[model samples]
Target: MIAVSLLEEYGGIIKNYKSGDFIFEEGNRPLHYYQIISGEVKMNNYNDEGKEFIQGIFYKNQCFGEPPLFIDQMYPANAVAVIDSEIIIITKDKFLDLLKNNSEISLKIIKNLSQRLYYKSVMAAEISSQDPEHRVLRLIDYSIEQLNFKKEEAGFLINFTRQQIGDLTGLRVETVIRAIKSLEKKGDLKIINRKVYR
Candidate 1:
């Protein structure tokens, strides 16, 4: 997102998003692509039966709402901040215009998209074969990928409830509990004080 922004003529607005705030609702017209500057955001869906499910959780610097922008369509899911967050909202006109004008930015965006596609493919493959515990581990791994390593709080930065973990991993709360217990017994992780196990 930052790469694509470099070519944009118009600068985006930095907006504050409180926890539990929705940036957009399902089927709302796509006006901008948003990049999370801080905290976590969740893209979620609801069935006709009123059961809600999370499509994805996005962390700091992660981008969402782009694919819909190009098609001039409504957002397919709701974008909500799981934590208090800051974001850059770039309008589609300006964002796409920038890409057309800047070769470097276009290349960078393409490269980034390619890597994202690969990650998504892997996630689809593994989610079917792996248990929830291992799937949670993979989420942590992806979330922390490209970390500086020397930075403090280098372990788990976002402390999530078992329910939220369940939302991401498609596990029920009880199943999530059992999976964590399994990891704990293996000495692979420890969940203490309801904070984290990594």
Candidate 2:
């Protein structure tokens, strides 16, 4: 992500959002580059039955919704604040100018996008052909490695809730609960005080 001072220099403005607020709706034209300053945001799409499939979760210092800006395409999913959040927004034109003026940040952006693409590819395959347990484990391991989940004395703490895990892995909440319990039994995971560890 671009440094805050640099974003400010490029005319970035901070905006606050309440929990459940929509940062952008699906199919909307990209107008700004958004980078989180605090709290969480999730990109998701709901099916005809109103079942949400979470595309991704982003945290502080992470940027979201850049792919559409780069391609001049409408957003494919809605971005919602998972909690009260502060975000820095830069006008699309200004953001482009910043990128043009800074090669190091541009390379970082490319690397970030590549990581996202890799995650999507891996999860797509896992969701398509893997069992619930395998899918859940893969997600936990990936998050630990890529998302920087905090480590505790017991193990690496999994920050995702069971419901979030299901949404991300395309499993039911009950399935996620059962899979976690199974994983614990198999010595692949641990549940300490209801928090999952790996």
Candidate 3:
């Protein structure tokens, strides 16, 4: 990960956003590199029916929207703050220069991107062919693997809301609810104090 001090030295500015603030909108030209200093962000899209689909969620010290910065493409989804968040924003030109000048950082970025690609591929398969419960399980497992979720004494605590889980897995919230209940009965997860753990 790139250090915040290093980013500041390279012309990055720290900005704060309120919950539900749009960091960037779909189809906008990518102009800045964004890295979270604290709090959560989600990239999402709305369908014609206004149903939301979450592309991904990122937390502290994570970078978002980098592919567009590298490829010069319009953003494919909207990035929004899931909570009040602080982010470091650097001009795309400066970010690219920073990457170019740091081979180790560039390789780390490549590895991170590759992991994201792998997640997308697995989710695509799950959404296309799996049952609702299977899809939900796969999504939860992916989160556990990719989000650095730790196993508590009870189990691995899932940080996402049911609606967020539905958005991520292409299921209706009702379906997600049913699937989670089924998963619980099967001993795959638990509802502890109204929160889910797996």
Candidate 4:
């Protein structure tokens, strides 16, 4: 994560967005660098049939939309606030300057992007050929690693909803529900108080 103090020192302003607000739409020109100060944001796209595919979900202290900004290209996916959120944003020029001046931050960004690329590759394979249960398990494992889910005495808690899992793995909600139950029966995960833990 980029240092919050550095952003504030560099004149980044906190902007509040209501849930369901479009932070940026697909095909829009990139203009600012954004880091979530609080709450959630998701990058997503919809198919012809109106089915939503989530590209990624970002939470507090996470940054999004940097790849397009660096490449000077239009946004390839839409960013929406998943909850009432506050984001720290700086002008594109300032953001570029910040990265150029901070080797540590730049290296961190590179590492983060590399992890994202690895996840994308794995998920692509799962979506292409894996069975529903396998895909769901892979997704949960990936989220545990990437999101740094804390493991308790029971297991690692999954914070995502079933519908979110469905979108991420290209499965229907009903399929996700069934697969989760099957996974639980197989001792792959545990359900407590209606929440899934793995």
Candidate 5:
């Protein structure tokens, strides 16, 4: 992510969003580059049956919805604020200008995008072929390594709720609960005070 001072220099403006607010809707043209300053955001879509499938969750300092901006395409999923949040956004044209003038930042952006692509690839395969326990474990392991989940005396605390884990891994909430319990029994995970640890 670009430094806050540098983003400000490139005409980035901070915007506040309430929980459940839509930062951008599916099919909308990408006009801004958005980076979180605080709180959580999710990119997701609902099926015809109103089942929500989360594409990704982003936390502070992370960027979301950038692939569309780079490709000049409409957003494929809606970006929603998971909690009251502050986000710094710059016009897409200005963002491109900033990248053009900053090679290091541009390289970082490329690296970030590559990481996301790799995650998506791995998750796609897991969701299609893996069992519930395997899918859940894969996500937890990825979050610990890539998303920087908090460490506790017990182990690395998983920040995702059971519902969020279900959404991300394409499992039902009940299935996620059962999988977590099963994993705990197998000594693959720990549940301390209802929080999952790995």
Candidate 6:
């Protein structure tokens, strides 16, 4: 498997961590590329008010630490562990070497960056829409179509707290709650044990 190959090639440098661990902090120079072998990683940024805004979430086998790969710089956002995790870290130099030697990986990196950009645009456009309830649905649609998430894991892995969702979707938390209630009322979605499903 590709996973096995990546591990065999880069496993020695990985670090194991627990929930609440800070994988990498904002403003920190990123010297490595992070590959999540298991568990979840939250990409967030904090406002001056000290409120954290969730930007992206990675599930098992997903990866981040990309801006470093491109511009040789620090990340503007924080990468945090939302669950116990194992991460394989490939140094920036090593990753650059790999990309230079392997065109396939370089192409994959380009594709990933393109996808990230698209997601950014979609989120911005959806949040800018005037309809708060539609904003919530747009957020859900963006997650399902863009992130390849199922209806069930929408609220969890997209994993925004109500406040975070409001911040991201440009809605008030109370409005988000009402919208979710509306969805439930229409039998279009269901939440049970903190999970949402259609």
Give the alpha carbon lDDT tens digit for every residue of 81-121 in model 5. 99999999999999999999999999999999999999999
User: Which of the two candidates, 2 or 6, achieves a greater TM-score against the reference?
Assistant: 2
Could you tell which candidate, 4 or 5, scores higher by TM-score? 5
Cα lDDT tens digits, model 2, 53-167, are 9999999999999999999999999999999999999999999999999999999999999999999999999999999999999999999998899999999999999999999
Q: Which digits, one per residue and each the tens of the lDDT, describe model 3 over residues 120-166?
A: 99999999999999999998998998897878999999999999999
lDDT for position 132 in model 5: 99
lDDT of 3: 0.94
C-alpha RMSD between model 6 and the true structure: 3.2
- Each candidate structure's TM-score, on Cα atoms with residue i matched to residue i, is 0.80, 0.99, 0.98, 0.97, 0.99, 0.84
Model 5 C-alpha lDDT versus the unseen true structure: 0.97
Q: In model 1, where do residues sit more than 4 Å from their true spots?
A: 1-9, 146-158
| Backbone steric clashes in candidate 5, count | 0
Task: For candidate 5, give the lDDT of residue 77.
Answer: 99
Cα distance off (Å), candidate 2, residue 129:
0.3
**Candidate 3: segments with Cα more than 4 A from true spot:** none
The TM-score that candidate 6 achieves is: 0.84
Clashing pairs in 4: none
CA RMSD of each candidate after superposition: 3.1, 0.6, 0.8, 0.9, 0.6, 3.2
Instruction: Give candidate 5's error at residue 8 in angstroms.
Output: 0.6
